[model samples]
Target: MSTIYKSEAGASEIQRRYREALRAWPVPAEHIHVPTRQGETFVIASGPEQAPPVLLLHGSGANATMWRNDVTTWSRHFRVYAVDLIGEPGLSAPSRPPLDSDAYALWLDDVLEALAITSAPIVGISLGGWMALDYATRRPDRVTRLALMCPGGVGRTKSAWLFKAVLLRLFGRRGIRRSARSVAGLEKLQDQSVLDDLVLTFTQFKPRPAQLPRFSGDALRRLTLPMQVTVGDRDALFDSADTAQRIRQCVPHATVRLLPGVGHSIFDQTDSILAFLRA
Candidate 1:
């Protein structure tokens, strides 16, 4: 088995499921695998060939499949590139460089170059949001806009979930299901299939072990592009309030939204995010 998966058979199952998801992709798409210094990076491209390019970066432990619900709507107006982040449970390479280093940014540089994108808007969630921020801060000129959801780094990442997850793991599948629901805020998830998929994927996938490296106030201040951030007030993974406050303080011009009674997962914001990207 690849180091990222628990077993070889499990890896095959994940890949098979991923391929099935791609086959059922809501809209027509072109799957492109770009070679980077890290390794091969998988990307799903959809929508008008000449339309404005918009990048979609999924959170850790996820792949391009996470955007299946949102892509059809977003692609109507933009050429969407849903990238399978390297080292995740996707078709991408399992080359997880240190999160604290500039390697990720450099890897992205290679990706954008391979895709022939000069600059474009980026939408990211969770760990992906942290990556978008990292890249934007390091190379602000390349990002036209940013729309982030429950991004890490800016907020104080909470450890409560870790303890809960560890304790829950002892109970096997039932415990894992409950833990996944808690971490993903599955209570709000409207799609049953997504829940099932999440449970199945995590059962075999081993997520990155390192904590996301936090971005400094100075780094956030470098984001002069149009930006939008949304987080759930009841987020179990990070201090959403701190995330809001930090963005307000550091990126004063950026728009921020804190949803009440929500959790780590924010869903069904297709229109709002698209509006922000289009604006």
Candidate 2:
């Protein structure tokens, strides 16, 4: 849990690179401040506005920057809109306590309604996947298809990384460093390029940490589309085999696969995801 300051060379570099990356991305990205009952969410839209829109969601402690690399791939076939979950640590506003599934769903629906995007594929990573499924189930008419990357709330307690990150946020500034490398799930994010993406997520949204209620499975029986579920073979929080089995029980034809040695960052599998979306 190393604390990084603005005076730190690496921290400053991450900030410079983030601004440059946003400026030089392949497609046009406009930030949307969509308001909801609780607060407003910052969503980034890439590709053509008229193209079929696809929503991308990031995991906890991360932001829309998680899907930066993938936006280039998804833009060719569909308009890509990646969101910083309202209460996430990215560019979105924070919510007070009393977080709930219905609140999450309502906030998400508000974003879509404001954007006038009624139906399109939703690609969610970790918590994003959890929200996608919850939104689809609650208002089935809004989501066209569900493509979850090792979705959350599948009855896994370890799905949350906040427990381990607490010490970092509290003592990171004093050089109480943990192997930032072994922050648990992210693999090789210390590399320069990967580090840039992670840094953007960290700086863009300074999350106000709060406990998320354990995700419920009330929508399991409500799935109604060509669902695709993929997880990493070594995912610490996601049980790939069990997750696939559960998804199968709901949508029999749901295609599921395990990416070996990749852990829970399934959205990092750009080629695999692009192919899945194209199919």
Candidate 3:
């Protein structure tokens, strides 16, 4: 919808490019659309049908393609379902229900029921991490394990980067690229294609302005399942230190990794996440 994109043309272009990316999915995958109260939700299902299921939830403004680098390795051992979160720049509907409501958890319930999955491990990043926490805490009996990368809700969201991003946008495309790289912590990354994709995405995508609701200590203490959190020390979006501290204080049993020089968009975490999922 226009609410999610700058214009109709941008929406069409984003979807067209998304379809192009899906065609070149690293591993063999089946494109699926599950019906939910919100609308049709898109998912990329991979790995053997008999393998244990592992759900993957990417951050805001990203689709299942965010998992392209890791899916090949992860799918080797588990049935991977990379879901396109609603209201994001994915093939899913642009329906954004209130974050304070039960809409997301219910939508996930529909997805799980449709997939015939009783319980499964979940891997989430940034915004997806918040949603994963929301669902797991509400439906604890349904989640086997949790792996979060720079997840929101547990951390204090920052506003400094946003102000800088806004200023950088005034300088044109070059400035926008700088803002994207800095925000994503991709400054040292050698992957030009990844940066290119990031630039293209932000140029047309209208990111959700609402900040994720921080999880209360009471809500976090309810998670007793196997949990692992990895965040970068240099993250500009969320307070990585606060996230680490809360998880430690609330869920002592959870494994926490605070990377020295990571940002909001963490990459090359395939093996670490796979180990957590398989553990």
Quantify all predictions' global Cα lDDT against the true fold.
0.92, 0.68, 0.92
**lDDT of each residue in 9-50, candidate 2, tens digit only:** 544555465456566666778878888786777888888878
Q: 1-279 in candidate 3: lDDT tens per residue?
A: 468888788889888888898999999999889999989999999999999999999998899899998999998999999999999989998999999889999999999998999999999999999999999999999999999999999989999999999899999999989999999988998888778778877888888878899999999999999999999999999999999999999999999999997888788899998888877
Score candidate 1 by TM-score against the native: 0.98
Query: Who is ahead in lDDT, 1 or 2?
Result: 1
Residue 229 CA displacement from its true place in model 3, Å:
0.2
User: How close is every model to the real structure, measured as TM-score?
Assistant: 0.98, 0.78, 0.98
Residue 71, model 2: lDDT of: 81
**Cα lDDT for residue 47, candidate 2:** 86
Clashes of each: 0, 7, 0
| Sort by TM-score, top down from the best | 3, 1, 2
